[model samples]
Target chain A: MHSWVDGQPVDSVPLKDRGLAYGDGLFETIAVKAGQPLLLDRHLQRLNEGCRRLALVADHGVIRSEVLAYAVALGDGILKLILTRGDSLRGYGLNPGAPVRRILQGSAPATYPPAHGVEGIRLFPCATRLAEQPLLAGLKHLNRLEQVLARAEWQDADHAEGLMLDMSGRVIEGVFSNLFLVRNGLLLTSDLSRCGVAGVMRAELLAQAQALGIPVVVADVSVEQLRQADEVFVCNSVYGIWPVRGCAAMSWPVGPLTRKLQGIVRALLDI
Target chain B: MHSWVDGQPVDSVPLKDRGLAYGDGLFETIAVKAGQPLLLDRHLQRLNEGCRRLALVADHGVIRSEVLAYAVALGDGILKLILTRGDSLRGYGLNPGAPVRRILQGSAPATYPPAHGVEGIRLFPCATRLAEQPLLAGLKHLNRLEQVLARAEWQDADHAEGLMLDMSGRVIEGVFSNLFLVRNGLLLTSDLSRCGVAGVMRAELLAQAQALGIPVVVADVSVEQLRQADEVFVCNSVYGIWPVRGCAAMSWPVGPLTRKLQGIVRALLDI
Candidate 1:
């Protein structure tokens, strides 16, 4: 893998970095296609919002230029940008003068079974639940132990992703992707105001769906509601979309809405 | 600062480390005096439990010996041990064969206002609430953005610590310490089974208080109950104890029970 730290070609970050000490950072995994980063604007907007909410100081213009340059060098691959609150000397208190650390890593494009998209993938029902913290919710911050634990719940090749629910037993999202279900004709997703990452793909899909006059609902989705949906799918910027065939005992076919949205996402991702 | 990564004298960790990636790790802050690591057994026990809960494989014996060696070399200071799930290639799924990374860093002993321990300190009632996650509640895991946000709530020197409550509006803990209150001559602390760090100092104090014939209660503590307390204090491994004088509209005297427990803790920490 090729990487950079603060615009310098380096593979390591200081030990005192708040990113390592306290997970005081935000990360974005962008898909690179033909020397260009896909969904660049959406990722940068989210990063800017994250920095503002966390009171982390960072130069967005610099980050944008660096990521663009990094993508061009890699040609086709996955680019991860990590923006940390920078290093501190053993404390929760922030150093007002500390510079924000930006790390960019490039790796070969992720390859998964083609059948995952052509056919469908089973979702492992994770017992771990996402805690409600509106302050840190929606932003793809570094504190993601919940997702780590949830993903660790399954090791077999059958399940492509794990379904995670909020502590209140409300269906939230997939371990690594945003979840959506179709009921009648409406696209329904969990309300991330309470918990879950607001994926760049999810934002793009919502905008494109609305532009195409597809009804979308962002509300609290119950397990029963998910079970009753006509179709289910999971999406991320890198993978675009994957139809969810079954989760544990309940099953759903790859309905037309799922395929239509998947096609749109594929075109958007240029995959 | 003197630091070691995986028993080697190094000042940086790989960018791919899960500790920096997903905060998939645990940490312990220990106080060292006269070449001895204070409460060594307690710290190791907590680390072992954290590893077990997170399904991260680590050898406790190696950690104990490494910390002992690190502490002896430092003589007197604060020692921080960070155990991460090593490195991974951009995913939440655990690398089954990946080795756990152990990092040790030694720093100068913390210096705080002497009056914080003698006269008392005011608690800043933080607006940031701790989210309840039974799976990740008590363990001093690396996902500490909540504490970081809570600590950032106050920039003035007047407040020594910030008070954090759970999402359900229950008094949880101080941003970096565990909280305790004296009510009707009964020692009470918030139940960490739902949320909050189970500090080694808090555990030691409870055991010592019980041996000294003090009646202790570990239950849900509401804001009203805290306001009505006769005495209140906060404790952490680094700082022995700090008497709580006021929190917003409520104030409490440093009662005899608080002083007695404080004395025991001070002696135990050899401070």
Candidate 2:
């Protein structure tokens, strides 16, 4: 693995980094292929927005250049970028002008069962519920204990992901990806203003669906509605998109819409 | 400062540790006086309970030994113990039997104005709202962005702490401490079943209050109730206790109950 801290090669970070102390940071996982980062713009956009919302000072241009350099050095891998509020006194209060720490690291791309995408995958209904906090919603901040617990809900390889519901029982998203349901002819996904990370691939798919003249509706999605969908799938920037074949007792075939979107993503990333 | 990771001296942790990646960890801030740890058993008990709730395996005996040794080495300082699920693959899924990382670090005790405990401190009514997550409530986990943002709400030295409220407009806690309202002859604090961390000092105070034959109530505390309290104070193991003198248009004088608890804590810690 290769890594850089604040544009310099480093093996570790300061123990007092806010990223580890209070998770006062943000992160982006980008798919790198042949020294190129896929959906770089979207990832950077989300990171910048997260910094703005969290009131952390960050240099986007410097971060972008460093990420690109780290990705190029790795040649073909998965690049993860972590931006933290840097070190501060032992308290929640931030030091007004503390330096922002940016870490770029590269690892080999994940190897998932090929059948997961072709034959679709099963999902477990996670017992962990996402709390509704609009103030921190939609931003991919580092406070992800919710995701950590939800991801731990299932252990079987058959289940590629887990579905998380909000406190109100509204279907929010998957353990590490965004959820989407194709009903009739419209693409429906949960509105993330209340909770859940606004995933990069989810945004790309929504735009692609609109460009393809498919109706898209972002609203509060119910598990009942999800069970009745014509097709369902989960997406993230790293893994692209994986169709959902079964969740609980309900089963779904890889519908035409899911296949088409998969094709679009594959072509866009040239995978 | 002195530090250790998994019983070995270390200055940094792996960048991919789940503690930094997803805040999948628990921390205990301990107060050290002379050469002994204050409330050592209580801190470890809470840490064990948090591990049980979060499904992280931790050997209480071993951790207790390590923490005690580290604290004794520091002699006079604040000791912080962080137990994380260690490094894992890129996804949120655990590595089944991954080693749990234990980090123990000591820093000099914080220096606040001596008048904070005597003359009382001011609080800023934070705009940040705590999300209700019962599954994660009462546990002092690493996912502390909410507290970080709330603490950033006020930078003035006069506003010693920020008052955080839950989504329902119920006063939850101070940014770095648990809140208590002294009304009539009773002590009232917010119930932690829905939100907020169950601080070690707060629990001790409750038991002490009961032993002193003072009525204590743990329930939803509203902002209006807080404003009308006979006296208000915040407590944490690190700083012990600080009475509240003002918050917005409301002001409070340090009452007898506040002074009594302060005296009890001072005696208990022998500070």
* Candidate that scores best on TM-score: 1
For candidate 2, what is the DockQ?
A: 0.88
By TM-score, how accurate is candidate 2? 0.98
After superposing candidate 2 on the true structure, give the runs of residues whose Cα lies further than 4 Å from its correct spot: none
Output the number of the DockQ-best candidate: 1
Cα lDDT tens digits for candidate 2, B75-136: 88889899989987768888776889999989997787878888999899899999999999
lDDT of 1 by residue, A1-271 (tens): 5699998999999999999999999999999999899999999999999999999989889999999999999999999999999989559999988899999999999898889998999999999999999999999999999999999898899999999999899999999999999999999988999999999999999998899999999999999999999999999999989999999999999999889988898888888
DockQ-based class of model 1:
high
Candidate 1, residue A253: CA error in Å?
0.9
The digit string of per-residue lDDT tens for model 1 on B1-271 reads: 5699999999999999999999999999999998899998999999999999999899888999999999999899999999999999559988877899999999998898878999889999999999999999899999999999999899899999999999999999999999999988899999999889999988888898899888999999999999999999999988888999999999999888878887888887888
Candidate 1 chain B lDDT trough over 10 residues, lowest sum: B89-98
Off by over 4 Å in 1: none
Flag clash pairs in model 2.
Answer: none
TM-score of chain B of 1: 0.98
